[model samples]
Structures are given as C-alpha cells and as structure tokens.
Target chain A: MSGTALTQQRDLFARLVTLGEEVTDALDHTNVVSTLGEEELNRAIAAIGDRALPDAATSALAALAASVERVIAANDPHRAIDWIGMQPRLALTLLAATLNPASLPKDVVPPSSGATVAARIPAGISFSDAPRDGRAVVYSGIQADPILRPLAVAIANATPAERLIARAVMNDPEPTAAEAAALFAALPSHRTTTDPLVVGALAIGGKAQASNAQYRGAVVEATTAEMLRRRPVLANDADRLVRRERRFAIDGVSADPHPFDVTVEAGPVPELWDCKWGARGIDASLLAELEDARIRAAGSSARIAIGVVAFDTAAIVAARLTIVRAPREKTRFITLETLGRLAAG
Target chain B: MARAVSTPPDAAHPARRPARFATRGHDAAAAHLATLLADAPPHALLIVGPRGAGAGTLARDAVATLMCGEPVDGGPCGACRACRLIASGSHTDLVVINPTGESNTIKIDQIRALAAGFALFSVEGGRRIALIEHADLMNEDAQNALLKTLEEPPSRTHVILAAAEDSRLMPTIRSRCAVIRLGLPDAKQASELLGERLGVDAPTAVRLLRMSSGRPGPLIDAEATGDAARAHAQIRRQILDFAATQPHARLGQLGALVADARAILVAGDDDGNAADGTESDDSSDDAPDVDAEPKKKSPAKRSAKPTPAERRAAATALLRLWRGVARDLALVSTGAVDQIAFPEDRAEIEAVAHRLPPATWGEALHAIDKTLSALRRNGNPELLLDAAALSWPTL
Candidate 1:
C-alpha cells in the first residue's frame, strides 16, 4: 500500500474510534442505554464481534462497546412506568416486547407505575387524608398505613438472618420513606460508578442525574412481587398446589418452585401458575420461556398443567409457523376475568 | 401490530354501513341506548371508553338518531336534514363542547353556555342534545356546573357526556348519568368496515384497520385525508433506512421521528400532514402543549411525557408504525410471508430480518412494546430511542 493510502486510512480509522466513543457517551445519558440496556448492549456487541473487522481497529471498537455497556449497566433500572396514572395492558405489553430475555440486574418485576397496595391506616383519617410518600405515617402513635406493614412486620417477625435486610433499610434514611418502604427493606447495595466511558475531550456529558429517586427506583420494585403474592384469586388458586403445611410466598426463595412464578400441586401433576398485573400484556420471550418450563415439567407428571394469569394484560406470543397456528393457542393466555371461572376448575 | 391483516372478504356487503347507531364494535351499548329511547330517554347519558374507542361518535349518533325527523328502523336516517346538520356540526339542537385550556379542562364557562343552549327549545322542534366531548376534561368546578344540569335535564332535552375514561369524571356527574362504554370491533369487523368505507380491497382494509386500531370512523377520515397511509409509509421507510444511516445521523432523526409520531397519532391531520381528524376523541392530536402556558410544564413533561389518557391512545399511535414494522420483521424472520403488515416493504423487511435470527425478532417486537410502554410511562424519548439503537442488530 502507498504511504498516502495508509495516511488516509489512518485518519479514517481515528475518526471511527472517535465516533464509537461519541455514540457511547451519547448513549450513556440517553434512554436507549436505560431501556435496551446492559443485556442488549452486550448481545449486540457480541453479534458484531462475530463479524470480521480490521485487526488494528477491533480492540478499540470492542473497548468502546465494553465501556458503553458498563456505563449503561451500572445505572438503576429506569422506572419505565412512572409517568402514567394507571397501568394500561397495551403499554406494558409493548414495553415488554422491547426487552430481551436476559434478566434485569435486579430481576424482580417492577410495580405498576401508578399502583401500590392501599395501605391500612389509623382510624379517624380518611384514605385521601393519608400521606402519599413511602414513610409509614403515624397519627397519635397509630400505624397510619399498612402498605409497608407486611415487610415491616416480616423483618421484625423473621427468625434471625432476615433481620439484617430490615436493619439496613432502617439505617438508610432514603429508602425508608414512601408507600414502598417494605419494598425498600429488601434491596441490593445502592452504588453508582464515577468512571467515564471515554478519556479527556470524549468523556460522557450530562450523565447520571443522581438523586434519591435513583436508589428508590430499584428498591421499590421489591414490593410489587409481594403485592402479587397476596392477590386474592392468584394466591387462592396457587394454594391448591401445596402438599405440605407450608405456603410459598418469598420473591426468590431457594425453596420456592422454579420455572413458574407461583407453583402448587394437589393432584398427581404439579400445577404452575405465573401471575402478572402489568396493564400491558407480556412479551413473547417471557411467555415462551414459561411455556418451555411447562414442557420441561411435563416429563415429571402425567398431565402437566401450567397457566399464566394476568390482570389487565395480554401476551403477544410468537409462533413456529405451521405447528403453531395461533400464538394464543400454544400458551393459554388467561386474564383476571377468566380467573373467576378457574376458581372452581 | 399495525400491519395488513388477513381477513376473509365479505364481498356481498362490500360497503356495509354498519354504523347504524353511530358505533361499530359497540352493538350492545347501542342496543341499550336504543332501549332507553323505547320509553323515555335518560336525562343524562355518560358514554365512556378508552380514547378513540368511539364514545364521541356514539354520543353524536345518539343525538342524530333522537333528532332525525325520519327515523329509520332503529336510529337516525342519515339522509334527513337533521342528520346532515349534525354531521356538519352546525345543528342548533346539537351542542358540542370540548376542553379549552392547556390543562385540557372544560371550564365552567363552557358549561354555562351549554346550560343556556339546553334551556331553550330546539330550533327544529326536536330534543335538545348537548354533546359534551371529553366530559372528564371538566375539572371539579366544571363538573359541578354540569352536575346540576345532569340532575334533571329539561323533560325534552338530553345531555350526552362523552369521556375517554370514566374515572376522570366527577362522581356526581357519573352517578347522575346512565353510562355506555364502547370498545373496539374485532380486527375482522374493523377490516370489513374499513374496506367498505375506504373503497379498498379487504386486504388493504385489514392493513389500514390494524393501523387505525380498527375504528372505521378514523380509518375513513385517514383514508380520505391520506394521513394514515402517509405517516405510516414515511415512518416505515425511515425505520428501514435507519440501518444504512450513520449512527450520528440517526440520533438527530429520532427527534423528528418522535415529533412526527406524536402528530400522526395525536393530531392525525391537523398538522397539515393528516387528511382529517378523528372525532372529538382526536387523540391523533399529539400536538405539543403549545397552547398551554409553557412555563407551567416541567422540563421533563415538556420533552417525553404524555397524559395518562394519551399513553394508551395517541402517544402509542406512533408506535403502531413501529409495531407493524416489528411485526412484519418477526414474520419475515419466522418465514411467515403471508402475515406481513407491509407487503410493499417485503424485500427490505426480509433483508433486515436476515440480519437477526428469527428469535431476535420476538425480542425486537417486545423491545418496541417496551419502548411504547416507556414512552407512555414518560421515559425520555431520546433515552428510549437510544436504547433501541444500541440493541438493534448491526450490519
């Protein structure tokens, strides 16, 4: 190659490097990173890596992608539903379609953006007169709200090891505030990296609007699972699965059944039911995975019965062409309306 | 997914004017309203449904049917002078009111005008029907003003209160009015309806119906004005072109795309691009709060957030294009050519489908679904689009 050709190529190569850094820096602050997020970023990068690129530029591009991936991953999961008043099934299902199957960093499903279990309150004050924030309100020393009462009691009531979580949330002044306090009680370590994706002039701009809400976003997600646990029809139906005196309610308890959100067994076959309350229906991946779980569980029992019940949500299931004529047929999509009929069945 | 639906043609009734009671999917609600007229019509009627779910249309139809001199078998004879006047929105007996402020609230002043009109005898000597569009847009004060009129509307007068959702209405208003909730027709019904109205084939009707969310009223308007096909075609083209465009260029394009999306969804034709607007439920009116006091809006709200009502209606409308594109991509990836939303874009969609494994299309579809949710949830548009750009398969 001529020296001039090499020089032009070098300039182009330098620009490409700069471009990668710029996109990542821009993406870090953008919703794209927060939405497609770490899992998507990594997978896309891996796919690109499978393609051939110039040896000299490969390392630089890979490093840029990695830096972008880390920056995106380090942040708290964006509370995707915060703006809306009530969860709408279409909104939730459409949002679910965007996510890949790789679990979130804090894998627990987030709460309905506008919904929380109505807290039990002290006498005399009306429901509207109660405090809307996370802090457990007290009036004349009476516990004014019961949204967090379960978690508070659970922490106080657990044998020994469980107290550690309760103690941590109590110590952290931030998470202890709001209707989501019980949610805050069970939280991963709250921290964010100060590192930038690029050096000097290429450093990320306008990144991380760090605030109390950032930490609160992830911590509050814990309560949504708990809310689903006490849901009348779901809990009652799941109760039929229990053979022993014990009932499974923990979010990610080691002893809890796998491949289904709530599992129970009364007959020869173990009955698995996954429950969701997002206004929007679920995405194909979540549905596909659960259906696969049912197929897997079918080997153990004569009749494998698995059901997914949602409140105000539907699933946009995918199909494998001729074998699967309708996505709904493969995965029986049950609504809260249908749950009433299943009460006896 | 806003793609062409594959519905079997019902050719005998190529143009079945099934909107007899001014509704398509709401047969039961229409029947109930008809039954009320069988004796004495209710003093106040609250018609509720999701935005674009045809509450406004039903309200208007009820008024037209009530006032039409030549009543058909069940409802309004569309050929009558009263029906024509109502269709033109110039009838003296048919009064229409809407939100007039940035907060999108129907103030007490509008209610007062409605009262004055209702107090008078009908010019055509028919029932005085005051059709309040977006009745929930009435704040506490406006609703209170409405409550009095609703309490005992004149013996011969009728007030049809239309709302996107019932919760937004005051309890007093809700309690006084008999409610009629409307829903969407199944895709098949919507397709047949659209094909008849638009003078299109069943296949084209189904595609258009899917995009319009199966509402014949909007589909017909969009077809005449060409906003539905125009916005979708341009947006779909832009999405396909996104792959070849530079990463930096794509960033700037997102702002335009989002803006166009909001307009197409919220203000179907008012933006000059839309042919005509949907009924009073013109959520396709995704215009920025330019009319409102801009200072009152938070910086966050100014950028990405839509009102809760718009989350499922207008705001998500733009995503219909994306949904269709994603759906077609998934179909192509899965080798389901017959189910493609955009047959014209098949070559491009198939090529793009090849870039990612068939399974990835499911994730892409889900991702778009999540994007819509996030957008509705008020997630920043730039941030949300950026996430999608990151996740999209690279060439």
Candidate 2:
C-alpha cells in the first residue's frame, strides 16, 4: 500500500473504533443504529484484514458511510451516536463485526451475525416495537438506560470457566451433566476441548432444537453423549438409541401399543445405555414402560429416582433410571442431580 | 382485554351512523374501494387498521353502499332499507362473525360456516356480505381456511375483514383484497366531530378525542366502556405503587398481580366453592354478573407484572390503550370539544386530571418503550420488569 493509503487505513482503524464506541453509546442511550450502513465498515474491515473482498463490498461500503452520515444529520454532532438506542446499536455493531475479519481480537473467535442475532433474541420480545421505518436501537453501555450492555461485556470478557458457566446457564436454567455436555459442545474453538469436530457435530442438532422448551432437556442429553464420544471418557462409539415420542392411544382391553411421530435406534449398543430427557424426569404415566423394561431385563438390576436440578430461579424435578433389575416393577427412580453428582465425582 | 368504558345504561338514544372522520392520505385507497363497491365485484375486500382507527365503520359504510339498491354519489344513503339493516347489524345478507360472548378467537369453523352461507344465497338478494371484526385474531388455520374463499370469492359475495393490526393478516389474504387504510383525525377535526355528534360536553369531548388518539371507534368505545379514563388512572396509580416497591421483589409482585387479574376476570367473585353451590340457582342472573367480572378482572390483572416479559407485555398493552384514553383526556384538558369519553370513568378521570404534567407522562412513555426493547433480548425478564417497576411509579 502507498504511504497515503497506509496513512488513510490507519486513520480508518481509529475512526472505526470510535464509531464502534459511539454506536455502543447510541444504543445505550436511544434508538438510532438502524441509520448505520454495515457495508462501509466491512470495506474498512476488509482493508484492515488484507483479505479478498466480495464484489458487493464497494456498494455495501458506500451504504454504510451514507447511513453514518444520516445518523449524524439526525442529531447534533455532539450527540451523534449518543442518541441511538441499545438494541439497534448492538445489532449494527454485531453486524459490522461479523463482516469484518479484523474485528475479532487475535485470541477471540467470532460468531455469525444478522439472522443469527435475530434468532438468538428471545421469542417474547417483539421486533414490532423496534422502529421499522428508520433506525434500529443502538446500545453500548454509555447511555442513560443501559439495558444489555453489561451482559454483553461480560459475555465478551468471559474466561474459559465463566464461559462454560454462562453457556450452561443460558441453555438449561438448571444445568445438569447433560446440559453441561451440550454447553461443552457449543463452546468456541481455541477453548480447550478434547475434540473439536465432535463438539461441532454435537451442536449441529441446531439451537432451534436445543432451545425448545419441551425438547431442550432431551436435546441436551443426546448432544452431551455425542460430545463425550469425541473424548471417549464418557462413552465411545455409542449413539442415541431412542427418545420420547408423543402418540395418541386407546386404552383397550386387547391391543398392541404403537408409537409414532419420532423414533431412534442405537447404531451399536451391545455396550451402551439409552438416554431419556425430562423436566420432572420421565412422565409418571410412563411407569408401565419402566416396569416392562425391568421385566425385559430380568438379569440386570434397574433404578429410578427423582432429581432436583436448581436453576437461577427455578428447579426441574426429574426422574433418572438405570436398568439393574430384570422386572420392570423392580426398576428404581433416582433424581438427575444424584446422577450428575455421580458423574461429576 | 377490551372492556366496556362508557357509563352504564345511559338514557336511550337513537341509532346513528358508525363514527367517521375525514379520510386523509388514503383518498386513492378509498376511491379504489368506492369503485369496487359500485361494481360489486365478486372479490372480497379487507379493511385493516390499528385498533380504534375506525376500519369497522369504513367496512360498514362500504357494505351499506353496495346493498343500498339506490345510488347517491359515492357514499351510502343512510335512509335506505339496505343501509338501515347493515347499520343495525341485522341485515340478512350481512353476516358478522364475532367471538361467541367470551370466546376470543374467530374460529376456522366459524369462518367455514360463514363461507358456506356465502356459498348458498344472498339475504338482500343483492351482494352477500360478511364482515369479520377483529380479523387479526384468526389463527393460521382459520386464516388459511378463509384463503380459498378470499382467493375465489363467490359471485356477488363481498367479504370485508377488518383488523386493528394489519400485519397480523397473511400476505396471501392481504394480497387478494383491495385494502382501505383509516387513520385518526387530526386534533382539530377529531375535537369538532366529538362535540357535535356524540353530545359530549365540548371540553370533555376534546379530552376523549386526545385520549383516544383521535381514533373515532375507540373514542366512541371508550365512552361506552367507561374504562378508558379509569384505565389511565389505574395505570398511573399502579406505576406509582410499583415505583415505591424495591426492584427485585416488584417483578414477582407485578407478575402475580397480572396473573391474578386475569384469573379474577376469568373466574370472578363467586368463590369457586360459592359458585358451585349457586350454579343451578339463577343462570341468567349470574351470567351478566360473570360477564361483568372479567371487565373488572382484566385491567387489574393486566396491571400486575413482576417479570420484565410480563411487565413489558402488560405495559405495552396498556400503552396502546392509554394513547386513546390520554388523547381523550388531553382533549378535555386542552378544551377541545370534538370527542367525549364515556362517563363511567369520570370519577377516576377527575381524580388523576392533572396529577402528572404532560411532559412527565411523555418521559414515562419513553421509559416504557425502553423496557419493551430490552424485553426482546436475552436480558433477564426480571431485570426488564425491574426497569419498568422503577420508572412506572415515578410517572
């Protein structure tokens, strides 16, 4: 790069950081981040990273610059970015960082932006409240009403242990051994992990499935088992055998029970155990199945217990079972916490 | 969540036209509607708007004109037999599908029945009309069920689906209709209309108009329900009560309050035990009482919120209602005479009449807006409630 261009690039980096700071403040204060054109920041980011750029890069860059200018015009110079709202600011900043390779610190890993952020935002909040016609809210912690700034900062600064805890807390209100396994699977690369590809594979079940209120616990269990296979300490070459499936049935005097909607089978389970996921543990209504399992495994003993897993504000009472007795009636009920403690031990 | 806001059993008054104001910014849309109504095209027509913006009146007017069997310019001749029946909501050709008493959703089956009827014959022996109110509340299945009817509307059958929220309709549903949008009158026009037409005192009419956000339906409905002014007072009072409470505990209390309010509205004062014993005694006498219970229960329950999600939801809902009420009251305060609020909330309205300055109310609104945005993220719901819980009382 020529001296003038190099000088301009250095100036651009400083300007970008300042923009980031202003965007953060704007989000913290008001709602104006939608006035941002992320494309402009991408070009700057691309130049900083010295990598190839897409054909659309130039137009996107112009749009970003124009948006910034619009934001400036909407408010006084002193209050330029300070007037934006938190949500829009966070959205714009996250969007810019996603497009720019250089934004991630040397040690830091990056996540995708746009629909990813939209997806991560909890369901109950309405995007309708966000200004649809103009700008998204800009938040960076320097505003009178700082909503998620501190939380964002904490996530950005999390240590390995803290990140693990944060991940678990975010997933299951009550982090169980199963939940931990899912969190482990979700962690960023460069964090110490036994096997990266295995962890990635585990998360491929996708957050959409993982965060579902009904399926989350089961998803955690299934994902954790997969994560363990990466290291083999928990289990090796074992896959989920079957999971709970809802089916309408008849209480007939004579009829065979059939299940539909979903089913699973172990790839190879001569040396493996099946996993069941539940909040109050498996349903009490399913006790007949437990008894049947016990009867089917007469040579083996079974146990079942209710587990109390405490989250930040709530607790899930679950039932865990291990087939040790042959008779289904001989099956035992154990709480999941006890199992978690046992696993931890 | 909608409740009666007007005084109870006002001296009987003659039926008048559905409330209306000057059509602004929507002349082209309205003109398109007029032409379609003139031709009585086989296609269904959907008129959508925010709650209280008067979409229903537009639909009613269009139907009246189509079935008039006599033409006088583009508007309906209010004196004609067809116009009279449509206005009275008893026209055989005009089918109105509303929630059955306490039922909330406009069911798919209900739409199917309406479609079937439309498929049969016209009562007016002219254009068959179906006006579905609160059209947005239709579930996806119901919306889809209406799609076939909407896409290929029967000969001489006109369907007008009106909603307070237009976005709630399926794009497919929307694309099929010629949409007519309605908006609240400007302050001056709304003020004049309320005073001359509704018999509201000049000053109170202005207040009702401002409080109703210049929207004629809500402006009229608020007076009828008598809850608009009362709700504004209750919201203000509740915010003050919450503001005094510590943040952490306030959310839980607010949430509990909201749930309890819903329960109370849904269940009412006859303690479950008492109701069981009296269940067979006087069903008719008890039914109205039961109906009245929810009217009381809803606002109280809605005002309860401890978690941010519930709090923000409650607050946002309240704000939507508040805009109309405050507009009514503001008109009253400003001495504008176009709209008169229902007389029921007169007492509460008077009590809070100048408790907070207008600017402070504006600030409280902004704070509520902030809480709503935060509720959208992964931020703790409790914290969001905390923010509102703190700011709400100060207003």
Candidate 3:
C-alpha cells in the first residue's frame, strides 16, 4: 500500500478500535451517561427519526443492521447473541427497528420476522425457538444480554457525532498535536466547532499540558511534605516525628488502613495528613478516613488530627464540607501556606 | 552375603528424602528469610514472584527451616527426622494448600480447615508450618477466612503464602503478611544453575537461560520447557510464513497459529500441574483431608478433555505471545534487534519485519491487544481471531 493510503487505513483502524472500546466501556457500565429508561428510550427513538444523520453514521447504522441479519441468517444462535452483545449501538438499533420499523430511515431496515428474529434472542434468556409477538419479549431478550441496555442507552442519549468524539477522546486520553488535528478532521462538520465536548477534547488532547499538571502535582506533594518535615517540632527527630506513605492501625477501620501521605507523631496526639494538589483531589473517601480517625480518638484526652493539606482554596473548602461530620477540634483541613503553623501546633 | 549393618530409620529411604532448600539468584530474599527464621519470624509471610521464578521453592524451604530439628546455615539439614519426613511429603505438621477442582480456586472451606488445624497443638512438638501455593488463586471468601489466622495465629504456627501474582490478593491479606519479592536471578548464576541442573554445556545453558527470561522454574523443568521452546520456535516460523501470504490466504493459517499457541500454553501447564500433583500427594497424605475434593478431582481433570475455561485461558496466553511477537517485530524493524524477545529466531523475524513498516507492526500490536480485550470479555474466539487475522498487514 502507498504511504497515504496506509495512513488512512491506520486512522480508520484506530477509530473502529475506539468505538469498540467505548461499546465495551458502556457494557461495563463505566460510560459517562447512564442507561436510558423506557420513557427516555422512546423519546430518543422519536428524536432520531426526525434528524438527518451524516453519511458516516447512516452507513454505520446500516452496516450494524446488515451484520445482525447475517448472524441470524447463519442459524447460529450463539453467533447471533455474541454479535449483538459485542456492539451496544447495534443492539440498540436492532431493538429500535423491532419496536417501530417505520421510525428508522429507509436506508436502515430492521431484521425481518420469523426464524431470523427468533434466533437473535440470547439462548441464556430463552431457548424457545417460537417467534415472539410483542416488542416486550424482544426488549426483555435485549435486556438479558448485559451489554445491550447500557450501551444502547449511551448511544441513544448521545448523537452519533458526539459519541464518535467521546470515543476518540477516550481512546487517546492524551493525544499529540498532530493526533488532535487528525481527530478534528475526522469529526462531522455539522457539529459546532465551539461545542464544549469539542473544546474539552482539544484541551485534554494536549500531551504537554497533561504531563505538566502531573509534574506540578508531584512537586507540590513533595514540597508540602518537606515543609512539614522542616518544622521545629519535627526537625530533631526526623524518623520518629514524620513518616511518608505510612499506614497506621486505627481501631474502628476494618481491613487495611489507608496509607496517609504524611503522618506526624511529634505532638501529644498523632496527626495523619494527606496532601491534595487541586480542587478535583478532594473526594468522599478522604472524608471517611477522617471520620474513622475521629471514631478511634473518641473518649481520649489526646485527640488525633486527621487532616488534608490542599494547595487550592477551592479544595480546602471542599475538604471542609466533605469532613463536616468530623469534630473540628480533631480535624485539620489546612493549606500548604499553613503547614508550618499546623505542624508546630 | 555379609551380615547387613542396621541402618537408621531416617536413612532407610535416602532417595525419598526431601531435597535441601536450594535456589539460584534469590540471594537477598533467601538471606532475609533466613534472618526471619533465626530471629522472631512473622506469623504470616507472603512470597511474591512470577510463576516459575521459584517462589514455591523459596516458600517450601522456609517451612522446612522452621520445622527442621537441625537447621544448617539457616536451611534444613535434610538428614534430621523432621527434614526426612518433610522431604518425603509425610510431615505430620506441614500443610500445603493449592487451588483445586473445576473452578481452580482455593475455596473458603479449605481455608477454614487450615485455620482450624492451626488452632490445635503441633503433631511433632515443633513449629507447625502451612504453605499455601498459588495463594493468589484463593477466592475472596478464602482470603477473608485466612485473614483472621494471619492477623493472630496460634503460638508456634507460621503461614507462608506463595503467589505468582500478588496483586490478585486482597489488601488486608497482603498488609497482614511480611512480603518477600523474588525477582529475576543473576545471569551468571542462573546460567550455571541451568547448566548444572540440565547437564548441558555453558553455551546451551546460556541460551536456555535467556529463553526462560532468567527464571529457574521453567529451566529446571527441562521436558516442559523444551516442549514450550520448540512450540515457540514453530510459532515464529508460522508467523513469518503467514506474513508472507496474501491477506485472503492468511486466514488459512489462523487454526495453525491458535493450535501452536495453545500447545505452548498446555506444555507449561502440564509441567505445572505435575509439580502441583506431586506436592499435593506428598503433603495431603499426612495432613488433614480438607482439600480432598481438589485432590480427587485434579487427576480426573488432567486426563479428561480440556474445559472451556482452560481453552479460554490458553487463547488468552496465545494472544499475549502474539502481542510480544508484534512488539519484537517493531523493535527489529527499528534496528533495535538486541531488544527483540526471540533473539534465536533473528533471521526469521528480520525476514517478516522487512515486509512491513514499523508503523504497521505498531498497528498490528494494537489490533492484537483489542482482540485480547474482547476475548477476555468472553467474545467468541473464532470471530475475534478472524478480525485479528484481517487486521494484520499482508505481504
């Protein structure tokens, strides 16, 4: 193959793989959008009926329909079930076509009734070879195949162009400039260039920015730990006073104790501190740890302080809100700027 | 005939005695184990390493040292009554548990029995040691059952868990045990050991060492290792031949490729199962019959037809090997021949690499990875293989 043709083939291969991955992710229920309910499902089908799909999506939908028909025609129930389960969008399209044959465009047609539709039913759900009358039976069969519902939901909720963009971004979390350009070129021109999905994909696709953010996070963590270690109370007896990435046994916590970023033992009460770089770093798990520490220190004269030292003001606020249940006196939600004071106190 | 002098009972079956704990290229881990045995050893110890890297050997040796009447240089003397019994797999106090039955998992019942046994006094008035081989295979309930014993074991009891993949183990179980990680042994030591064990010359031993990736487990099992190596060689040739064919004709080679890959995996498993069987028979005869189900079922499974799970596992293993081949081709194409995995098949690899651009090899690798991912999710093997074959660059 010529160089240009080879490149184009590679690009096409990447897109197909990305779509497969997204379908798998949807099956695994890790997609950003949740599965559509009965009402929403009907609305999506109605909306799709009115919209004029791009040539690529129309072809893709048609291809999925054709593939389903072929698998059913092969008279292999196993193959038919597997083929449908592998692609959520295909399963959705099939279900939509079965529900309302008139809803889809003339180019894409649902599989005809008889043994073809009967074979498409997953064997796990029903072994009966009899043709089902209602859309309910077909819907139930699709539901029995675990990947179909969530995948169909994700596909139906998002436009074809949007799903394509999402899959591309998902495939390459950190794409190079040239890769980003190629991705943009592949996207349908109908979708607005200024859409948030397009803008977000471009922003995150910059490999340098992702690496820089990671580097900065590491630097902040190290710097915070060093500053805490340099405090007068913690300086003289370094080993005993400060520990990094250490897990301490607390009474109430079950299983293994979480490894705190920094643990200071110089004060009367032991202090476990975790350093967060940005607002996104503050989460529920951090709060649970603080609460567990609080429970362990209950009814004791010496109060163990479970803290989070965040660099961002927003993170500190979020941490404070997240740990509202924990006693204020027993918790230390501070910033790096106040690390020295907190350590000294 | 001259009057026969009376031999000691322990010396009656000298050939049957357990071999002294010996390993190649795990000096630091061995030393640490020795130190722990001599001093206050942890109640629970986790020996983490790849399968065939000698984690099982290390764990067994550690147990022997703990139970030995006379330990020499922190190892079992192999002459004492305890050592003799342990070696012969008749030690009353030593218990070994492995994944058993069709599921191939260490179940909660087996673990509960082990815990129950530990609650009692030692049979021979020495330290009671339990070695859990392939501990990573233990299901969640089994791991949880083991956690209580790991946290607070009875006096004079030590549990050693040997696992190929430590990540499969629960964090609670891992945190409770002192971990000893075994890595690839030193090249010189491994080569010498392989040579001595296989009775091969230095150059052949060196080649075998490289092929086994410096792992003593595969090298020591000469027959299985040899079979696997031969299968791998055949696979390299097949890949090259397939690459030379037209795109449409390449599908014809899929069956041969899959069969060759499965052969390689089965060869490794045959040796592994044999080793496990011997160990199980030796240990279970004297210990409690808690793992009786697995013991009874393993031989039958071995002789019978392969289960679907086993076939899937073999297919997964083959895809992994194919991924490596694709990566090696890319490396060879980029003039990094030294980094290629199959250095022995350099000529064939070069011939294949010459036909495709380095980028094409990368694409092939990606395609294989996607196929592997799909297979793991229980996709139809035939369909996935067909797609993979179509994706590869045609000569």
Top candidate, metric lDDT: 3
Cα lDDT tens digits, model 1, B1-395, are 11111122244223233346756666666666665554466777777665545677667777877888887755788988998897787888877777776576789999989888888877988778887877777778888888788766776888887776678777667777777766765567656666666677776665555455444544454343245456666777787766556433454465467666654553232211122111223342332211111112222243464443433343345455666677788889888988775777889888888877876777777777676555544343334454454334434
State the fraction of real interface contacts model 2 keeps.
Answer: 0.00
Off by over 4 Å in 2: A1-345, B1-32, B39-42, B99-103, B192-199, B222-367, B370-387, B390-395
For model 2, what is the error of residue B179's alpha carbon versus the real structure, in angstroms, after optimal superposition? Answer: 1.8
DockQ-derived CAPRI band for the predicted complex in model 1: incorrect
How many Å off is the CA of B281 in candidate 1?
15
| DockQ of every candidate structure | 0.02, 0.02, 0.01
User: Candidate 3: which stretches are off by over 4 Å?
Assistant: A1-345, B1-19, B191-212, B218-222, B225-227, B266-307
Clashes of 2: 98
Pairwise lDDT winner, candidates 2 and 3: 3
Give the Å shift of residue B59 in candidate 3.
0.4
* Better-scoring candidate (lDDT), 1 or 2: 1
lDDT of 3 by residue, A1-345 (tens): 122222232233233333434444233221211111122233334334445544444433444333334334444432222222233433233333333323221111112222211112111111112234474364334324433223323322333333433333322334333333333333333333354444444443332533434433433344445555545545566555665555555342221245566666544456677776542354557767766755655533335667776543211232223223322323455532233334344
* CAPRI-style docking class of model 2 based on DockQ: incorrect
Order the candidate numbers by TM-score, best to worst.
3, 1, 2
